[model samples]
Target chain A: MKKLLTLTAVGAMLAAPTFADTLRLGAATAQTGGLAPYDAPVMEGIHIAIDEINAAGGIGGTTKIELIEKDVRSDAAQTSIAVQELVDTGVSALILPCDADPSLAAIGIVSSAEIPAISTCASSPTLPMIGGDYMFANFPGDNVQATVSAAWAQEQGHDTAYIIYSPDSQYTTMPLYFAEVFEKMGGKVLGQDTHSIGQQDFSAIATRIAALPEQPDVIMTSSYEPDFPSMLKALRSAGVTSQMIGSDGIDSPTTFSLGDAGEGVVFTTAGYAEEGSPLEAFNKKYMDATGSESQTVFNAVGYDLIKVIEAAVLAADGSTDPKALRDAIANLENVQGATSAITYKGTDGMPVRQVSLIRVKDAGREFLGSPSPDAALIPAPRMQ
Target chain B: MDIFLQQTVNALALGGTYALLALGLAVVFSIMGLINFAHGELMTIAGYVLMYCGIAGLSFVIAVPLALLASVVAAVLMERIAFRPVRNGSGATMLVTSFAVAMILQVLFQNLISTRSQPVLLPAMLSDSVHIMGMVIGVNKLAAIIATVVMLVFLDWFMKHQKTGIAMRAAAEDFAVARLMGIRANTVIAGAFALSGLLAGVAAVLWVSQRASVDPLMGFMPVLKAFIAAILGGLGSLRGAVAGGFLLGFIEIYLSAFLPPEMQEFREPIGLGIVVLVLLFRPNGLIPSATLKAEKV
Candidate 1:
């Protein structure tokens, strides 16, 4: 009787649609907090991709994609809870917000569950090293951006530089990588300083730069948005006439508030154009649906992640199994994205891509250089 | 010689900002036995007020007092609406209530504006620096030092001779006794919040001036620094708060200025040494209270 019952169950399973199940993606990001502005766009991007796939008769012809989101509120403890709940509900993969704070909080739990996860904007090159094989960062690797930033600075005839780095690893890594690249290219690092994140007063740091015996040709930094403007204003107001260069951290409208203080500041960040590519169409769709302008490059990254995931799933021959998806995503190469062409190196498992060189001029961002294929690639780590 | 002079100005400006914020927090704690964690939100509201005024193209001189008035009004309302109801509650309850108010204000600000820090345009003249004695000092920084010193002196005089001020001091020392002595708790608390708000507004201008931006959580760091100073100076001691604030800022700025490039990252750890020093030799804080000094500060 037991054999007959098992045979009957198998028969019923066979009668259902072949390879049919909802491909569940868990998003553990802040819904309300400092990171919400970043998180909302990524979630929308994922939804946009899922809707596109599902509209065309779903993945594998019958399986639809469902998103499970828990508002971690940028809280670490809440992130753990959200991760546990998402795993218990059986999500195939997990996605994190762009910034490092809360997203790094959730990646560990997902790794332990043997589930695959990708970060939208956490740029630490060291993430994949510690994140196990199950985790990947979708944003351009920090090392890649730093190298390009150095090359761009050199191209602009900057032979000497000073740096003020953010205290956090995710932020300071850019300046760190830039230092590596700078020294490699025979540039002198006149001076370097580190400031704690959220430090509003840059007068002391500014005075240090001002008091230098000979001002460097360029001043570089790795700080994001709010801190970026404060640091720039202080340095500029302190009579340090040296030009400034920085990472994507300086790509904030807030930097423009200080008028001439922000003038001539150069930086590197993600890019997207809406002229001739599918990104243009997608941008229109996104704006129409969300009723809000895209806040930063993370919006494009969010849109790109969904497309990349779709490609990876297809590369796995339409399998939503975590191990299969993880392998496929790790090996994803030359996946055309809205921001740029993204390719994950099999050696380190981080996406390598190009960034736009932007110059700050009178409260506006003007493109200084276009994407360079040679400059954008992340150099593989050498075995010492 | 020039470098030394410039760094001194840097330290002085930084200290003045810290001292003002510390005094703001200390004012409420001294009178009400409340830490007033939501004190920072007063600054945030003020920034928003200035931002809207700037949007209306109001001159910087006109915006300053308007921002101050808005901050004071917000702080008074906070005391009336949030604190007055929980005025007699346990310490933990009052703290939690303050946190709740802070969270509410934060969310409201976020919904009304973007979570991202919005730029606050100041008068271009604010950025102008005066180079005297071969060193440049930002005008805003110079103004900050003057404002802080003036406010502290005025506060000292008011605390020493004014009727409401003495009642506040009496309430801080012994609330029950002060009430028995015909002091109305309501008037004293409102007055304390008003003064606290005014100081926070001054600190806000200094902060917004430096950052050129404002966001809902912009007040967070200033408030934290203020709390640290208040504790380091001796909780509930106004003079101690001022002394601790300046000392904290000086240590932080000088460490950054003097530390070698290789060791500059240790700036924060070195600055935090004040907390250790306080905990060790002077747990009551580095300065004695006004009452202990036998002279009103």
Candidate 2:
């Protein structure tokens, strides 16, 4: 009987899994280039999320999630290379931040590998339309944010508004969404202007806005931080002080540093860390680890992505098969996370969560409660 | 009318920054026969130095000069370590070396400083706006323009009359012949880099004062503009580079101001279009130097 027991124990030891049994996860993020600002916060989120999972005994009881990072260097070609390398390394799923164009460039490669891919931040509607079942975004697309922001402005009694946006794919589409919603809500867009990214001086645009016969009650802009401040400075210098509103891109520390010029500039964004939210705990963890505030939406997304992956892994019930893991992620319904309750309803539906609208006051951001659904349009009587 | 005048003043201020940047590029290109792509990185380095000094409790006045001095030292070192060895090498080799140095500097900056953009603080007076003729103007921009003009004038005098400057010019004109005249090739090249870095340092001050922020890649736009300006003004001519800088600045600003809002983003491209037109008409740039005649042929 002792000899039989010893043989059984040796057989059990031989069946035990090694590091090769762990599931590999790859992140192809903007490690360089223009999008680095957004990418950095997302990476931080990924690290925090992954750490939380590992601490909780990891996935499937036996297989831990192993993270491998590759800097796409913010190039489309590099993104493809990074994704292929990660897939080649046998990662079960690939994660990326919210850059629409570059993310699109990597889709063919990702799909060809038969590996599940999710963009934690890429909110462009084009992604889902293109990748079908293979692609998912953790956040709402630009249209949703734009719709919500315009609705909020109308609720605030902003009837006459000036719209300024870049013609670039990301920024241009956002303000167009706002304009469509605002006009439908009876708001008269007094003027529509366009500027290119990286064009510093906005004197001409400012002058045009100032010269309008009917001055806009609010000025809405869609651009990133670099040009946003300069635009605001030019407007302020010209004494054109229509209340300014920006898209999610305005949620940057650099926006506030525009000094008095950036005062009262409000914008919309996904919730970062609100009081009594799970993210508050995550924020504390981030601060402790990174020694800096997780200020952007990317931070929260980063934190939550790890949770989503871990949840999917646990729900798989000790299965390390890639196909099983992919199905597990797709079936994630109402998983409560620090950022939001993430649910995947396949490729055809929106994530069933509300978007947050934030405001800049005294050079700091404040979450102004979740916008009302009707906030996308002002009441019809006030539109005139 | 007031707005137009204000726009012109804005153009002039922008032109000043451009002139300084172009002058730096021209100095290095003329002496070394290679464009120092790292020239913009030199500006970024100096800006960071000023930022460090300011954080260390030095006044902007003291910090600015110290930063400029540091830039000179860095430029001299770069010449000695990176450029000097490759001096007699092919133009492509020197160009590639400069690009390598720029990449190294960019990575160093991103690792050491927070890659996230940070605001560059300036003294209160530099940020304040002044009104003239019913138009608003930034006092700092005005100061930048004046400083640029003064530096240009000083540089012109030095290049024309100073013995060292004359020898450097001689080297630029004919390096082989200048060596025969007992002009040390290393001295002229080192001086050129020093002067280039000095101008870059000053330009950084003006640039950071206006933008109020600094990042690792902040050098990119300015450097590209400087390269274009150097070419537009005549590559081998220092005065022409300064002229090209101001001219490019004015053209960019004016185009942005006068064009429709939809076309404002195209201002730089429009300015470049004009430069192309000038090149097509003149072939050797707007102010071709006599020394570059053989090269053009």
* Best-matching candidate per TM-score: 1
Model 1 residue pairs with clashes:
none
Residue-by-residue lDDT tens digits, candidate 1, B1-297: 777788888888888888989989888887777888898999999898888888899988999999999999999999999999999899799989988998999988877886767778888887878888888889888988998899999898988899988988898888889999999999999999999999999889888887778887777889999988887887778888998888888888888888887788777877787577764777677775654333323
Residues forming the 10-long window of minimal summed lDDT in candidate 2 chain B: B119-128
Q: What tier of docking accuracy does candidate 2 attain? A: acceptable
The runs of at least 3 residues in candidate 1 whose Cα sits more than 4 Å from the true structure, single-residue gaps closed, are A1-21, A48-63, A99-108, A277-282, A345-347, A373-384, B160-163, B290-297
Model 2, residue A56: displacement in angstroms? 1.7
For candidate 2, the lDDT comes to 0.75
- What is the Cα-based lDDT of residue A211 in candidate 2? 58
